[model samples]
Target: MSSPTSIAPAARLSDVHVAFDGVDVVCGVDLHVAPGELAAIAGPNGAGKSTLLEVLAGTRSPRRGQRAVPGAVAFVPQRAAIPPRLPVTVRDVVAVGAWGRLGPWRRADASAHAAVARSLSRMEITELASSPYASLSGGQQQRTLLAQGLARQADLLLLDEPTTGLDADSSRRIRSVLREEADRGVAVVCVSHDAPLLEAADRVVRLEAGRVVGAPRT
Candidate 1:
């Protein structure tokens, strides 16, 4: 049940422009991501990489442009608002990914549980399935967020600095998960400073001062 865009670019931004107040962040940039491709948004701090991702996520509407980001998009933001001592468990958090089909109660069926379990294992957080979401460390929480994203079965995934709190092993695992997703025809666009992750991307896009200044990936 895919749309025409499935054959088109998974995401397409034409003459995209984003600004905060009087300052322009993303200016007249045209970018496209095909299905089964992994593209990395690379730049130094203040390069508007995250802002661009927000635009792609539909959280920030460009002041002017045409956006063609496909459906079934999953976004794992850099920082999430987590309440301390919440009663929700790791499995509950990851199950959010299937909410579109399973509903909030997660009473779908055994397949839903299997999907949740698989994502937990992929993120190496199966042992924490019963653990409280608020009880996990920053790295652990990051991994959980990633696992949640993986369980979504999204056609397009937008991740912002997904490995911020990860160690070498964790980072490697995350990269592997992203690669597997792209291989499964998921278009992955991640903003990262992690060297290995960027190296593993199918294409690399460079941004500077809010404009795509280099790279054929975009």
Candidate 2:
């Protein structure tokens, strides 16, 4: 992985603030994530970690400050955002990531299929490709969602609580995949409380009451 200072940032936020129902969730935070770096946002519940990620992802606009992101970005929200009863297969769900490039009417072609396959393999869910997404375990579903994000072939990847509630092996696999993605020159950021994930991250941004208390490493 290249040194963070050697390359331009893939995502940057300056003096960012986000509020919900007039209550501040993320306040006066600044962040920068460079290509080939894995950054972890760690905080307790209600600390605004997920909201900060959304601001970086351009999904939720901030109440104040600036966000700059260039190139394709893939965001995988918490598992609850995906309906458990959906009838899509694992492969079907992952293939949707390519639809952005395939456009609305175009059908999936060879390259699209290859992208989905590669993503599934990276998450170690290739064997579950044909299975119904709704039938999988929480860990399996999380991996599938991550694979979907990877299928985007994005320059920046953001995830929320990916290893929450997952078994040890699942968490380990996810951590490994994150490292691999960073090594492949994708900027990766995840909101997580998991110790292993935080420990493995190249940079850990600690948040408290929506404020960044420390960012100790590059």
Candidate 3:
């Protein structure tokens, strides 16, 4: 397994704050994620866990304080926001990861396709590569999304309740996959209300009223 200490700090939020609709969502958060670390974010409903993940993923900018994130980042939202009628195959979705590196004008070459294949294989979804993404079960869809992130070679992976609504077996599989990714030097930050998931993490952060209420401990 890749050591968490092996990779430098890839993300940091110093007293960060975020607000929505005149209400504060995240309040004065001070957090850091090192590469290869499996960090879990736990909090009550409406505690801003999802908001924090979004901020780190660059989907939402912080309203205050300093935020620093480096390298490639891949985010999997709670709902897996994928189009149902996109007409793109499962493999095609995973290949989208290479788009940023390939740029808009260039096409994905052999190396990029190889990465997509490896990612699909790693997630054990190679058999579904040609299938329509919408036809897969919830677990399969989540795995496919994970494969997409892996194909991107993301140094940081921010996941928001990735295991929500999954069966116990499915959830366990997803957790195992995340552990493998962390072992491979991908920083993993997951937000979940599930206590079991928290136990598997190297460190856990708790929040209340959008403020960190407890220090993270291994």
RMSD of each: 3.2, 1.4, 2.0
Tens-place lDDT digits, model 3, residues 1-218: 34445656778889999999888889999988888788999989999998888888888898898878878898877666778977888998889877655668898899888889998988888999999998989888888887888788888998888888887877887888889888877889999877788888888888899999885656
Q: Rank by TM-score, descending?
A: 2, 3, 1
CA lDDT of every candidate: 0.85, 0.90, 0.84
Winning model by lDDT = 2
- Candidate 3 segments whose C-alpha is farther than 4 A from its true place: 1-7
Q: lDDT tens string, model 1, 14-45? A: 99988899789888888888888899999989
**Model 1 ranges with Cα > 4 A deviation:** 1-7, 101-107
Tens digits of lDDT, candidate 2, 1-218:
77787789999999998999999889999898999999999988889998999999999999999999997988987784557677889998899888765778999889998999999998899999999998999999899989999888899999999999998888999999999999989999999999989999999999999999988885
Q: Can you give the TM-score per candidate against the true fold? A: 0.91, 0.95, 0.92
TM-score: which candidate is best? 2
Task: Quote model 3's TM-score.
Answer: 0.92
For model 1, what is the alpha-carbon lDDT of residue 200? 90
The RMSD (Cα, Å) of candidate 2 is 1.4
